[model samples]
Target: MAHETPRHWDRNMRERLRRGEAAALAELYDRFASLAYGIAQRVLDDEAATGAVTREVFGAIWESPERFDPRQGTMRAWIAGQAHQLAVARLRERAAGPAVREQVAAAATAARADYIVTAMPAPLREALELTRFQRQDYRQMAERLGINEDEARRRLRLGLQLLSSAAQYGAESADPTGGRPAPPRELGSR
Candidate 1:
């Protein structure tokens, strides 16, 4: 019997790879690398980090193929989301450090995003959008998301922190003003 390829082979292939097929994983890598790389590069706009994010996405596919539910969106959408999540988390963790130049370098390596990373999970992303990017305070972010201040703080602190570490690895830098500032950043990358 001949198999008629469905509309979403990439996702199907990825879903398969997730289920423990080494060959499928490699095939999925070859199939989605460019697309995934582009997405990661858009958000990160950097080379090394983009590559790392790319590898991580595939690694995730290998680790938890079950997570990619077709009901939520397309394979591309899933790729975009994972890339966004990894990028945001990367930036958040590395947001701290003594080297603005290094951070800039990291930015240089980031993949640009077609849709803003926030689009993946709007409310959570908005909640997680760093003050440096969304520029909203805990209260403002919470208000925007219609959540409570403590939840905002929790998301901003714990969620963002963990997000950062998972995406990359680093502790967020201390706010320049000692306390979190009120200005939202126009641009952000990890």
Candidate 2:
């Protein structure tokens, strides 16, 4: 069999693809899968993400073969472009994962802090609200509440101590160790 030139091969494949022939897609995959995978792997670096990008590019080609205009570029270039775009999109999502998680963690921590503050005794809660939440200095809090500076300072300290204890309690309770101090082991124990 005579080997067809690249241009003739691409043109014939495109025509078959436009006719919705599965063989055309198979030929295209056979020709370009490695190129697509290479481009995706370069951009994504991870095996799983690279595989996904390669599959998505071919899937898009399979679904919309007529979208490829012979006048615009060669099939190889088009497939590489598709792979690069998909890989970059996946990379962007992976890059943003940590930031999204941080935002969620900050929101959860704020909610937990709010719950602890609300459950406090009134005086401690009031002092924390004014000093910590409202960003008030001790003297300002004292003046606002019509109390002396010493009392304001004491309330703020006690509030901080209670908050610390609550956080520690939460940590201990959630620990797999069941909030108990580690037991002393016998010398002969495995």
Clashes of each: 22, 0
lDDT of 1 at 173: 23
Error of 1 at 92 (Å): 2.4
**Residue 59 in candidate 2 has what lDDT?**
88
* Candidate 2 lDDT, 1-190, residue by residue in tens: 9998867777777888878899888888998999999999998889998898888988887788877776788889899989998999888878877566455545544655566677667877788889877999999999999999998998888777655554444444344334552322221122
Worst 10 residues of 2 by lDDT: 181-190
lDDT of each: 0.64, 0.77
Number of the predicted model whose TM-score against the real structure is largest: 2
Once fitted onto the true fold, the runs of candidate 1 whose alpha carbons sit more than 4 angstroms away are 1-15, 98-190
- Residue-level lDDT for 134 in candidate 1: 68
